[model samples]
Target chain A: AQRVTQPEKLLSVFKGAPVELKCNYSYSGSPELFWYVQYSRQRLQLLLRHISRESIKGFTADLNKGETSFHLKKPFAQEEDSAMYYCALSGINTGFQKLVFGTGTRLLVSP
Target chain B: EAGVAQSPRYKIIEKRQSVAFWCNPISGHATLYWYQQILGQGPKLLIQFQNNGVVDDSQLPKDRFSAERLKGVDSTLKIQPAKLEDSAVYLCASSRTDGLENEQYFGPGTRLTVT
Candidate 1:
């Protein structure tokens, strides 16, 4: 069975501090991982993907195959970065390119 | 282009009552999806359509739920004899059918409350 897990329900950090949101997945084949963020009153949007290997809004995530983890990280947290984040896994077997998402983690950046 | 659109931002109805939600995907999108999101959890795919053809409905509860994307443009999801667990946000998303690198755009979602 394919599953995604976000261990933390909420993560709080001070401005300028480093932040990391953990995400893990269980899948047999090669899977594409993604991070999505939802801001207040805004629709859910893509933050970053492991395949792109690029940072978005100063946030980056690296997929570790050995550990089956794709953790999102930011060198320094910003107040504007606070939002609900979800990790998702996608594969080809499922028709129409379906995505299985984690429970989600709420990040709070305090000034 | 414009984002996905959904109607009835919020709805409150008693259990066992029937309800329907409408969604209009971005113009020219070839894939449309419907998801149910419970509070504090991620959205779960209920059904998926590829150009008005059913692609996946494994997770959809057919006993009380049904959906259709007529003409491959707009879609509607209906639930008859709703249950208490049905109280959640229904989100609609769309994406192009260009294989990998296709990013899905989501709508604001309609919040349903079951009494």
Candidate 2:
């Protein structure tokens, strides 16, 4: 079975500091990875995908197949970036794009 | 252009009661998904539909949970004889059927509290 693991349940960082939300996956075949963000009172939205290979809102994630990881990173954390982060995987299943998600990590950026 | 829409933002029901949630996906979207998000946990995919047809429902609890997306537009998820463990936020999301590049858009979830 495919699974996404976000080791940190809560990560607190000071504003202007760096942040890295660790995400690891367990899958035998190639996987499509993504990072979803849910802010307080806001619906969950896509932050970025591994295939896009582009940064959104100053956040970027690199797919490391060897490590089976797709860690989301930001050089300078901002208070507005505080939100619930979820690591999701797709393409593991044959039929539809059923997303497998991790338990999620809450990012808290202190000002 | 409009985002997904979900009704009954909050619901409180006793165990064994029945409840249903409605979801209207974005216009022109061909794929729809339903997820269950427990407090302090990420959302889990309960079911997925493509154009009014079930694509994946392996995770959905068929005995107690049921869902349908008729006409490939709106969908409903029902839980019969709900259990205390079923207390969670139900989320509805949609995306185009153009394959992998399309990302899902979510709606404000309906929080179900089973007491």
Where does candidate 1 stray beyond 4 Å?
A93-96
> Which DockQ values do the candidates obtain, in the order shown?
0.65, 0.68
Give the best candidate by TM-score.
1
TM-score attained by model 2: 0.97
How does chain B of model 1 score on TM-score?
0.97
- Model 1, TM vs. native: 0.98
Worst 10 residues of 1 chain B by lDDT: B95-104
Q: What is the DockQ of candidate 1?
A: 0.65
Residue by residue across A1-111, what tens digits does model 1's lDDT show? 789999999999999999999999999888899999999999998898888999999999999999999999999999999999999998755533679999999999999
- Tens-place lDDT per residue, model 2, A1-111, is 889999999999999999999999998888999999999989999999999899999999999999999999999999999999999998744645778899999999999
Please provide, for model 1 over B1-115, each residue's C-alpha lDDT reduced to its tens digit, 9 standing for 90 to 100.
7899999999999999999999999999999999999998999999989899998899999999999999999999999989999999999999987255889899999999999
Query: Is model 1 an incorrect, acceptable, medium or high docking prediction?
Result: medium
Q: What is the lDDT of residue A81 in candidate 2?
A: 98
